[model samples]
Target: MGIAVNNINKKFGQFTALNNVSLDFPTGELTALLGPSGCGKTTLLRIIAGLEGQDSGQVLLDGEDASSRHVRERQVGFVFQHYALFKHMTVFENIAFGLRVKPRASRPSESVIREKVTELLELVQLDWLADRFPPQLSGGQRQRIALARALAVEPRVLLLDEPFGALDAKVRKELRRWLRRLHDELHVTSIFVTHDQEEALEVADQIVLMNKGNVEQTGSPQEVYEHPTSPFVYGFLGNVNLFHGRVHQGVLDTGGMRLDVPGHAEAEDVAGIGYVRPHDLDIERYAKGAEGIVVQLIRAHAIGPLAQLELARDDNAELIEAVISAERFKQLDLKEGETLVVRPRRLHVFVDQPSHHNQDAR
Candidate 1:
């Protein structure tokens, strides 16, 4: 099922949670509402689920208005971060609860419920744990059971709010791949809320980046990451090395350093900032005469296939971060206190704007 929110507005006291937000979630595609906490991603999800009413605007499900529908009447399955499973019930019973609680006329027979629950358990690859209690299962197992319960009613739409947020890093990684495969097989229109960029980038077909109660940008992960519309989006999407500079003729001059800005060559000079990803920087051992910024390496951390380096500008002590492949690091034979020159291969220049500081993003 497709979901659409039109001109949605909501407020609490003097605080506005949603600012005339409008978006369309494509049919049979998984969309992610991604943003920092308190950005209204959760509020928007709740409104779509019919658990909270929007102050204005309409909620449409499958092209029909669903604003007046009750929570249970919406046919939306919701999975939460903490795995809100019933501790007192066995996994099988929990999955069967939704089917058994339907109105008498709609409720399935006992044998049918048993069959459906078994099918769901196998679908989630936990049929063996059907007899286990929620507390007896691992965190990952409990979350899978929660998902099974949500799917038991055969909802047309599924909503997951940080479904893997409660798990450790390793388990979260595992479940992310699992969820992506499950969605591909079912193709139920699904929307999940998450602040983790990697999760959204890895799992969702579409990404809606929200900020300050407004939708900032919407696109596939590659679109947003490769062609960010604003500085906020650039910084939020990945680690960026920001250069406070002024643009003149096609060059960005940051006091002691200057970099080429070919895209702005024909435009009038203006104060701007340059954003470059850490991996976009090319670092080399400093020589008597180097063309790029000279810096002294402060630290190097190599993990698996990549290495992260911390360096301070030789002239001003400005700290910079650079990411290079482990093989490159080995080629350079870099060590702390070694002087190096870094040239930014790609630079994105944006007109100077006040920074949007999110405690979580930093």
Candidate 2:
């Protein structure tokens, strides 16, 4: 089922949690609500699930007004970060809870419930642990059980709030990949809230990036990462080097280097910032009259196929980071204290504005 919120607004005492937020979550696709804490991602998700009411605006499910519906009425499955499984019940009972709680006329028979629970356990690949209590299961196993429980009633929409946040790095990685595969099989309209950029990038079909209670950008992972609409989006989505400079006649000149940015080609001079991802920087051994900024290699780390370098610009003593293939690093035979010339192969320039100004009033 497709979900949408229109002109949504919410407040908490003196602070506004959401400001005119609107978004469309296409049917049968996994969409991620991504942002740092206090960005209202969870609040927005809650409102959509009918757990919290919006101060104004509407929540629509399948093009029908669901803003006034109760949580039960919405028939949405929700999974929390910490597994909220019943401590006293066996995993089997927990998975069967939702089905068993339906009104008598609608509830499935005991035999049917048993078959459904068993099928769900196998779907999550945890049928072997059906008799174990929540405490007896590992964190990852418990989370999978929580998911099975949520799916018991066959909800039209599934909402997960940082479902893998509590797991170890390796477990989180495993679970996210599993979640993606499960979504493909079920084809349910799903929305998950996460602060981890990597998680959203790897799992979701589309990403809705939020900040300071407002949606900043919404697009496929590649689109948002490669074509950010704002400085915040560019910086938030990944590691980037920012060069503070002044733009004059389409050229942005920092103290160390300059780049042609025709997009901001106004004749008038203005403060701007040039953004360059570390991987986009081309590094070379410095020559006496070489083009690009000259920097001294301060640190180098090679792990697997990638090399991460830290350099200090000679002119301003500002730090710069670059990433290159491990093979290239070996070819250079780089050592600390050696000077190198670095130039950005691509640049994105945006007018400088105070970040605090984008935030809503407290």
Candidate 3:
């Protein structure tokens, strides 16, 4: 089911939770509502599920008005951060509860329900544990069962609110890939709310970034990551080194290093605050690049094939970071406080506005 939200706004007492947010969640696409705490991602998801009413605007499902629909009428499968399965109920019973208790108009026959429940159990790979209670299962197993329960009802849309927030790092990583495959197989229109930037980038087909109860920017993960529409988007999307500089002689210069940004792109646009990600930075001791004094060297971390170097730039500048291979670092004989050339082919320049100004705001 394709969902089209137009002019949607929400308010809580004196605070505005959402301000004229408009978005299109195309059918079969997994859209992520990503932002910091109190950003209203949960509020938006509630509005879609009919749990919270919007102050104004419309929610159109496949071109039909659904704003006035009841919560049960929306038929959205919701998964919460904490698994809400009944402890005494077995996996089969928990997944079967939704269908068994649904209204007569929506409920299927006993045989049909049995078939559907069995199918969902298999889909989530918990069929053998049908008789097992919630406490008998691992966190990942419980999550899978929760997903199975939600899917058994065959919802028109799927909504997840930090579904993996309670799991450990390894389980969360594994579940993300599993969810992507499940979405592909089911093709249910879905929206996921997350505060983790990496989760948003890895899981969503489109990302909606929000701040202060308002939408900041909405785009594909790559589009938002590579060419952020606002400074907040740049900072919130990934770990980036920010520089304070300006355009001199039609050239963009940051910390005395000239960038190759074209004149048409507005050198001063990001002049006051230029940005570069860890992957974009290069490290070498004074090899004709962005020169800076290393005031501090952060603890090195071994992240698979790459090594991360976090450096405190001189003069209280934002932390400069670079990701390099351990082998390359050994060859260069890297050390603490050593000067390095940090040159990147691409940099993002936000217009010289107050740091508070963002990409999309009411």
Q: Positional deviation of 18 in candidate 3, in angstroms?
A: 0.2
User: Which candidate number would show the highest TM-score if scored against the true structure?
Assistant: 2
**Which numbered prediction scores highest in lDDT against the true structure?**
2
lDDT of 1 at 153: 100
Encode model 2's per-residue lDDT on 231-281: one tens digit a residue: 889889889988788877777788777778776655357788788889999
Which order, best to worst by lDDT?
2, 1, 3
Task: Give the poorly placed runs of model 1, Cα more than 4 Å off.
Answer: 315-318, 353-362
Q: Count the backbone clashes (under 3 Å) in each candidate.
A: 0, 0, 2
**Displacement of the residue 258 alpha carbon in candidate 2, Å:** 2.1
lDDT per residue for candidate 1 within 53-114, as digits (tens), equals: 99999999988899999999899998999888999999999999999899999999999999
Clashes of 2: 0
**TM-score on alpha carbons, each prediction:** 0.95, 0.96, 0.90
- Model 1: weakest 10-residue lDDT segment is 353-362
Residue 270, candidate 3: Cα error in Å is 9.0
Candidate 3 residue-wise lDDT, 1-362, digit = tens: 99988998999999989899888998999999999999899999999889999999999888999999898888899899999999989899999999999889978999998888889989987799999999999999999999999888889999999999999999999999999999999999999999999999998999999998778888899988876777888889878877667654344566556554443243334445567778876667664433533335555665578888877665676677888898887787767766665666456655464442222110
10 residues in a row with least lDDT, candidate 2: 353-362
Candidate 3 least-lDDT 10 residues: 353-362
Clash pairs of candidate 1? none
* Native-to-model Cα distance after best TM-score fit, residue 169 in candidate 3, in Å: 0.6
